[model samples]
Target: MKELLILVVVTIFTLATYYLVEPFAHSQMHKHVESEHFAYNDLPKLTATGDATRGAELVMGGAGCTGCHSIDVAGMPAPMDAVTAAASYGVNPPDLSNAGAVYDAKFLAELIKNPAHALLVEHKFDMDKGQMHPMVAFYGTGGDLDQEVADMVAYLQSIAVKPEELTPAIAYETVCGRCHANHYAKWTQIGTTPTFKYEKESLAFQIQVLEYQDSLVKYMGTLPPDLSIYIRSRGEHYIETFMENPQNYLKGTAMPRVGVNKHAAEQVIEYLKDSGDAKRHEREEVGKYVMIFMVIFAIFAILWKKQVWRDLH
Candidate 1:
């Protein structure tokens, strides 16, 4: 009787599962899949057969694309001269060859529009390092300049260079030069780092700084609420320990533990504590407050001028 009962239950489950799930399986429409297959999965898919004729003009124009890449467009020269010219200013351009082969036009455009998704995958989504930078930042997470990225992609796709063509010096120039364009960038230039002094400042500034820290942490999908104020509240060792292994410090924390095995965590501590700007986050806090205030003030002024505020009384 027990054997018969087990057989009956199995039969019911099999019949029910097949009947209910089979029809849905054919369409798979239940899952909201925007795109499962990346057609630009290979270089051949992205290679353009159309006129890259006008693409050259867009490259040299105000887009500042020559800022990153070395294009072999019709009007422009090969590379050595143009690249050497830039090295004088401690700038090295990136290779544009085979870029089309590496990514499709759409992928290229998205990369420029929003670097967060375009970058090295280890930071977040391991699958997408598509055409984005790992270290360098661009638009996304409130980033922009989409049109420029489009133009830049057009230029990159026109060229067809090989991997060996990218030299070590050129690699450093195109990638790292974007930000550290001034100091710490010039291989020939070296000096003693100056200690900034801004220990004493406005509490309001400090508070906003704290908030900005929180925003960055939130963006990274790690610990929320920044450590700016913790200098006094939590102390240096507290910072050091968390920096060492944030996961260890906070169980089940999203912080993926960056530099515990190496002494990188300690180095970060030294860098942060000494850097006086940490006490006063210039762009992060103050800029955010200014932007928010401007938006609010504009709304209020508009309402007042239009007599909306008066009518409320």
Candidate 2:
């Protein structure tokens, strides 16, 4: 009788702990991001219609974006390699290949107007020196800022790659691998390693790409975290929300607002769900049986105890 009572108390305590502590534990991970949330539908609409063709012209022209970034569209040639660009700038600028698919148009326009303002980055000016780490305002397209931004946004959307089918692994490699190299490398080691799509590239060029990736830590101040366990550490909603507007989620974080649309975000999240917990389905199935066994065992134990104590009573 005493043992059964102890078991009951233990089970209750465990359930209480899980119900109470789980929420607090989850909240701590997102404490930095907590704010009065607003629906995205409430935001203001864009003023101008985007034009991809003209946007490509701006991207290639003296807006000087190409000077910093590397675009790999079919006709566009990267003027400078990734390594050279990262060496020149403190960080490797993001690839704009998927900009159309990833970013919000209004967000892109705001960023172009002022990078620091878009990011909400604080700046302290020194009397001896001018503004430090200031991104040059892009007023290209003959100084018509509105038209320039509109064209850029249009171009980004136009150039977005659409695939009939995208696997979780493919999404991770193409979208998330650039920054999360460690996670990619680890995942590759565990699973069947994927063949490089650029296998036809010259050996020297491949070497240069590898070297550039290795040197990213030098420029990025710290290597961005591996995403191997990111899905587990940060839940799907947190990841999706963060990708949408990093500044809103984690103030002062260096993670720029990515241009991923809802569909793309879902794809990445689906992939994460699989990659992060390979045994999730199996565990859930096992849990049901375990609970049933425990219940049956408890009943049997109680019946036996009652039988043993009836004589004493």
Candidate 3:
């Protein structure tokens, strides 16, 4: 009876403590909720049917997407590379290589019309009167706005990359891809792709990641190191430490604290290790059996010679 009373008292105390501090704890999480106005569930829907061909035309001609952005589709030429674009616009525009696969059509449409509206916080418009915003409202004057937006959305969707769902590769791209383009390109050449084991996948989620990465690059003058062989080069512990706090590894480095949690870092690290050393686990497995067989053969040979030479001995 006393034990039962004690258990009940503990349960009541836990519940009371939770209820008392819940509001304050929730308030503390406010800043973590990137956008105050928009959320995944609350994102507006795109009603118009998108047309890829029309969207391509809009991008090339009326939309002027090539002015700052670039897509490597067959004949389309980008106006400038990342470095040049950054110089001209203050922010490097992302390639639309997998934009279709990484962004929601509705969100894309909204972003085209108003970049800051889709973000968690309202951008400071007073910083620079006319030139600060990288992307201005692009409702095409030559074409119907809805149809143009739909076509652009359709074009992006049509060119979506494989493994469309979020994966470790996508995480790397969003978090580490831009600055480490050479590493990413090398991985792609070697046919390495991101794997999604624990995290959920979505284009909208990827767009948020791309946006975050871009913001970091703009703030920091230098691009971060390529992480393609980071596991092999720096080892997992170093990767984890550097990722957790870059300054710990290199003093006065431009690399910002990415705030990647343990689980996310593990996922990125696993992807890097797997991509860089794909045959490591396989080789280890085969080596064990080979060693076992060699030992067995040595023992058998010794026994056979001993038996055959017993009379001579």
TM-score per candidate: 0.26, 0.66, 0.49
Pairs clashing in candidate 1? 43-101, 97-161, 118-132, 139-143, 140-143
Across 217-278, the per-residue lDDT of candidate 3 in tens digits comes to 66455545556676787766667666654555565665544433344455567678766666
The alpha-carbon deviation from the true structure for residue 258 of candidate 3, after best TM-score superposition, in angstroms, is 14
Task: Please give the ranking of all candidate structures by TM-score, highest first, separated by commas.
Answer: 2, 3, 1
Range of the 10 consecutive residues with the lowest summed lDDT in candidate 2? 34-43
Output the TM-score of candidate 3: 0.49
Clashing pairs in 2: 100-156, 102-259, 102-260, 103-259
Instruction: Give the range where candidate 1 is weakest over 10 consecutive residues by summed lDDT.
Output: 184-193
Q: Which candidate's TM-score is highest?
A: 2
- Model 2 clash number: 4
Q: Candidate 1 regions off by >4 Å? A: 1-51, 72-93, 120-152, 161-313
Question: What is the model-wide C-alpha lDDT for candidate 2?
Answer: 0.63
What ranking of all candidate models by lDDT puts the best one first? 2, 3, 1
